[model samples]
Target chain A: MERLKSILLAEDNHMDVELTLEALGRHNLANEVEVVNDGAEALEYLYRRGKFSSRPAGNPAVVLLDIKMPKVNGLEVLKEIKGDPNLKMMPVVVLTSSREESDLIRSYNLGVNAYVVKPLEFEEFVTAVSRLGVFWAIINEPPPGSSRGIA
Target chain B: MRMDSIRSILLAEDNQMDVELTLEALGQHIFANDVVVVGDGAEALDYLRRNGKYADRQEGNPAVVLLDLKMPKVDGLKVLKEIKGDVSLRTIPVVVLTSSREEKDLVKSYQLGVNAYVVKPVDFHDFVEAVSKLDVFWAIVNEPPPARVNAG
Candidate 1:
């Protein structure tokens, strides 16, 4: 059996994490998610250092990143990932609440794969996350070799 | 009041079955935006630049471009390079919807600044589902770069 690719979620807010996990659960995808609470932890997971040192190798199928978080932050993480060739091909989706034009502009400028604004309403947010989970996790193909890449 | 913001979708595909399937999948959702189909990469460029048969086409860039890798005249990768190279067109999101699963192709597509890459599923049901989700995500969920607003 093929090993299912994991999902790395970098989000600081408890509510958003719960909500996002709930949304993914609705699609029967909650099991594949591996949550990290901050940008620094996100990097650790990606690099297989710190708390993630013993985790199995291979990049996540997709990264659902929140723009605002403690430590490095989403845009910083995006820049780091996109700059490195080994991690450049990894799909990074900016899942955020801010509608600030600058955030959108900078995220795209940093080569973000997709930018999705977190909707305010409960039903809308669920719907948005559901669509994201389905497309990124199930429909969109992760860059080839991600399943074998260590960094 | 909102009509001016409507963004078109440009689909560059040569295969008739794929084209029909994509159209049918999109039709299932009843998307309000126009979908312009081009048979080759050259025509895709022509449409983007508003030249030849597309001379009088609308002024705004597409919300997203669904490009197939293999096509006559120029091909998808070349088209992608051209799009990302041009300052005005660079901001337009390009999603590679191709059948190839080769690692080299995947790496090159991402490197070329293609926004997303999706493999065309062989199963009919899977194909339709993929297209529908992609159409919904790109057209309805994503916020295109401010370039479209400026063009509007």
Candidate 2:
């Protein structure tokens, strides 16, 4: 049986994480999300190293990355992913509160698949995240070799 | 003028039926009327670069480009390469909306820096739903790059 691919969400703020998960939960996709607090843990999860060792062998369907995080930041993580050929094809979307043009420009320049600014209003934010989840996790076909199911 | 407010979608599709279906699907959204459809990859590039027949068209890039793989001239992959390689156009989002589910096509598109890859659903209802969802995400949810005035 083919297992649904998972979405990796790298966010530091507990409130944002809960909100995002809640938004995705509205689409029955909350279970598909794997949360990581910072960029370092995100990398570890992707690389299947450190604490994430022996977790899985394939890349996640998509990564919902936050720009500002403790330890390694989102841009650095994006650079690392896009620069590395094996992981480059894996889709990464920047989900941040930053509406700064520089951040938008840099994310696209770094080869991010998409950039979505978290809406300031509560309802708008939920709608945005839900739409984003549905698009990336369901509508978009992830790259080859992405995680299919549990071993 | 604030170009970001202009949420135009460029569709490069050779198939007339597919084009109609895409337009129809996109019609469900407010930005539906903003779509600019081109029949082939050459026209796609022309529309993007503001060359040939499109020389006097516009100065800003579309919010996103929905590209079809097979075409009479240039083809979608070539068009994607040109867009991603050019500094001024690289930031513009490009999504491959093709019928082909071949692994090579998927790999090639991602390698060429396509923002997303979506397979055209076979069923009519599914196709419409997919496109509508895609439209909402790219046009409304996602933040497009700051508009750059193309210098000719």
Candidate 3:
């Protein structure tokens, strides 16, 4: 079987995670996802610390990050990743419930690759994640982060 | 290579099915667009530079470009390097459209300043939906940055 890249999804909301997983499952994409609950944990996973110490060594093809969270928060995490030369090239798409113009401006200013406003409607959210997978996994290309391209 | 028009999307891919699907997906979207199909990297560059068969084009730069990583005659990475390195065309978004899941494809594309990078879904229905979303986002929702003037 041809390998599919794993997706690292960092979202604090359990329901949101469930729904996202369900939606991806409907389109047969759930098998490729790795879910993390909060910003602090997300960073640990990215940095390979704590429980993530023994986790996969390679970088996720893309990171689906939620904005608000306990501990680090999405913007802070984004800042750290973008600031790290080893991880700066990793494609980050801000998938959050935020609708504020300030968050949008901040995310873009922070050099976020993309910013997606999460929809409250279940169908809309599903469609968003599905398309997000389609574009991030299927269309957009990235310069190999520290992991380093085409097989 | 039609050189007379600068408003053309240079697509690089070896797959006929994906090419057909992309065209079909674009048709469903409301955005009016014109895409120039090239089977490989060499043709993509040729189209960009208005070389050989593309000598008479009028549009100086295409609005956007969609590239596939694995291709004969130069591959996507080399093509991306050339486009980004060229001061004249660096502002234009060169998106990657491929089935590759390797980290290299992702990181390298971003490092090159590619405007967007995406993986084509294997399923047909998913492909249509994905393309439609892209059309909505890049063509409709997301605003392209203003053009850059050459620094003297």
Best-performing candidate as measured by lDDT: 2
Q: Which of the numbered candidates is closest to the native, going by highest DockQ?
A: 2
Every candidate's chain B TM-score: 0.93, 0.93, 0.86
Which model is ahead, 1 or 3, in terms of TM-score? 1
Model 3 spans > 4 angstroms off: A1-5, A140-151, B1-24, B30-94, B97-108, B118-152
Q: What TM-score against the true fold does each predicted structure earn? A: 0.91, 0.94, 0.62
Instruction: Give the TM-score ranking, best first.
Output: 2, 1, 3
lDDT of 2: 0.89
Off by over 4 Å in 1: A1-5, A147-151, B1-4, B149-152
The ten-residue window of minimal lDDT in model 3 chain A covers: A142-151
Model 2: per-residue Cα lDDT at residue B86: 94
Residue-wise C-alpha lDDT for candidate 1, range B13-97, written one tens digit per residue = 9999999999999888766768899999999999988899999987778889999999998899999999987766777889999
Model 2 CA deviation exceeding 4 Å by range:
A1-5, A148-151, B1-3, B149-152
Model 3, A21-127: lDDT tens per residue? Answer: 88767657677777888889988988889988777576777788899988989999999988887777777888888777667656655667667777789898887
lDDT of each: 0.85, 0.89, 0.72
* Residue lDDT tens for model 3, B1-152: 12232244567787899889988887785566677788889988888788878878654666567789999989999999998777665655677888989877777777776668778888999888777767655543332322332421
Per-candidate fnat, comma-separated: 0.70, 0.86, 0.34
* Candidate structures ordered by DockQ, highest first: 2, 1, 3
